[model samples]
Target: MAFFLWLPALLLAALSEPAAASAGTSICNDTGALHQLAVTARTDGSWITQGWQALAPGDCTNPLPEGYQGRFFYFRAESPGYQFRDDSIRFCTKAGPFRAGGSGDCAARGYREQAFARARISTDSQKIPLSSRSQAAAAAPDTDAAGGTPYTAAVVLQGCSPEQEGAPAACRFVGGGMEIRATAGKQAAVPAFAFLMTLQQGAPLAVEGELISSFGSHGDLDLHSAALRQPNRHDRLLRQMQGRWVSAADPGDSFTLSGAVRQVSYRGSAMPPEFVSVLDTCHGAGTAGDFLLARDSERGTGLCYRIQSLGSDELTLIYLPRGTRLVYRRLPEG
Candidate 1:
């Protein structure tokens, strides 16, 4: 997220004798999806960049020196004294300028200072390509901390089955994975941080309170977490009501709700002229009642309740079958 500005010191130059123009169809002009290429900064100054292209338009009106073979373009303000690791150097070739049409623009706009002159092909399943560099610069401070990578780590779900006994379900890394590396001053080290397997597919889960600060082989960074539980039948029913509902006409003379409702009222009619009576009880006028119907401790056909009466209090639902009235009590602060 930083930038460096330098006065223009170089201009495009024309080449006298161009290297033999590749014949028999250049790989850059393929019609299929532009294949990815691997480009490493070679110890020699031959190729210092790597990128992709489905159909490379013939050389620019003015190309670099006759042997100026650089293809993958990269730039960073932090070099020399600073260092970098876990940096991504791959980019997709596109039909238009800078592969703008693809889902991901490898180097989000405005970050280019130097451009590649040539690129080499990759040998992976994707048939990627890469460009080489002259000499490996001393590791520089990581300048691309926000870049998303295709790398993923292994994670295992644990403590959810009946045998775990009271332990909250948790997802944890079960195998070795890449570590984020960072440095400030002369101190360079890895932290203890784990990546949520869920993030690999790009599903949005927890953002805050999920990242373990400074946790991992490299400097600790916030990590993503996984979804632990799904909504149950009662939760689904409550959602259907849109947070509002009324008891049945008879209410079974003493019925209990299968799910939480926003309001509960009794309407009765009686008398010489048939007068109507309205009974308003527990819970706010437009707010959900204090408790949610839950499975009983006995785990039988009956129901129990879990109350959410006070903020930050564990819900404890109490089930009162037909013809039962339970008293509400509050204990004094100790």
Candidate 2:
């Protein structure tokens, strides 16, 4: 959701760090939306939790009062129609101005327990972005670099399970991490369907944030593996084969190809698309695969196809080497 930023009148005093040598952290609302802030921290030896720090877009606040000392702190931020999910940690909160003494049973003392996220505080007043944002986390591909129209890669990951109770370590366990071709960027975002058009033939990629992420699809292990699979050719044939495809001989069997190939099924049973890319030359079909389709980036790794027809209605790709045909028809989107 988009929010407009409103600057408070003559608000210079509130946004600045205290002139005296600082001891607490400074948080800036870079998300462009207002968020209700709550914090839990170890101050003086007692676990002190406080809240309702109204953070307007672009506004900054110390959150904690002066004389606060700690290497770390925690907070829960909520905008009117938005939720900033950081549930690996727990803290207590109450409606209206609240001051809780301990991180214990809240219901017994008229408080509600809510999950919070932790942040490392610095002795110096360093600015930290309290973000729950909607920026383009996916990098854009240049036409020259990706061999197609400019595009960006994007995916959404749902890590925090709402049914989960308390702070479970399982919530943060995202695995050894993922490998992805795309990086975070800010050029025009591409349609999810056009994701493949943005892939560079062979460009540099970095493993960032351990997001699907650290670029797996929504953090799925198989999906992330597929994202690392490079497409062999940037041809028109590749574009034509971009959506869900079902076997024309048997409708229940199908698979989808995009930035990653997935949702595959055999005899109506779900299966995995172990390798990535569908190209004209991988299978050594000298005439450019109007007759055959290759499923993997490397030859002899996946099913090879013999194309009978494309575009009109039923598209046929007869598996070569094995001589099995999987004629396909485009599945209409429901």
Candidate 3:
């Protein structure tokens, strides 16, 4: 869903620290000594948990937050503790060494509360409330009457006014957290794909709510990781692939090739005489559509092209390494 930013005309304020200084603790910061944790449950009733702390800001030696607060880390919780263990209590005091008692809610599971200059805190909504109409319909005796179990997520942005805009905007639990309609008898809780897409491209993000597990797609993770590494490569690919190329000549016109690798062509010819092989130049094999060709004088490869075209509509691209050029036009859309 798309939303335009429209706020009462007011002077934008600079991001400042909390009104009151915090002396509490934070487990969210990467380098803040407190370890952030992640637990993932698989489809086959299996799970994996990973924990690590992110790098801290300014002085790495600055005392870590003393209590449960702050946006210094990314926290993951599903069913509070049904599938994973809860250790918010130990985290508040110990800061480093922590242990999980058992599966429990965020508050009941032992998170500390204090008056320190904290960042953000998690909330519990007990249960998401359904509309009277929805509740009544759901009670109609037929299991399917209720909406089928799909990972449904309702994201609401409160304090949306500019006050908290750039302050690592928080995604704390709201209205009893999230409500999920599960398939009857399924042991797994559907994963909700939820994250705050910010105006800043690489600004850090944190989430402190429970969502269905389906939202954990490895494809998104891999793409995000790759983007962080070679950002320019992806940018170039996106730009070059979106070019609105105008065909130089109609395929119907009789054409003759005189370049290094010459081939004759008449109107509506499917194959081009010269093209640079994308595989040798870039990532994959170059094909007829949207290809750049190059020939080596000393090397005997007759014709080749960089495969700058891919997909049903050729949206992805394979470009020449550099200093290489291939000329060709796309087939006109019928």
TM-score of each: 0.20, 0.34, 0.17
Query: For residues 210-238, what per-residue lDDT tens digits would candidate 2 score against the true structure?
Result: 22221111121112211333323333454
Candidate 1's C-alpha runs over 4 A off are 1-117, 120-134, 146-221, 224-226, 229-334
- Reference-based lDDT, each prediction: 0.24, 0.46, 0.24
How does residue 188 of candidate 2 score in lDDT?
A: 31
lDDT of 1 by residue, 130-215 (tens): 11122224553333232422222222221111114554223222111112221111111111122332232212122212212211
**Model 2: ten consecutive residues of lowest lDDT:** 1-10
For model 3, what is the error of residue 200's alpha carbon versus the real structure, in angstroms, after optimal superposition? 11
Instruction: Say which candidate scores most in TM-score.
Output: 2
Tens-digit per-residue lDDT, 53-81, candidate 3: 22222112112223423333223321111
User: Candidate 1: lDDT over CA atoms?
Assistant: 0.24
Quick one: ranking by TM-score, best first? 2, 1, 3
RMSD of 2: 24.2
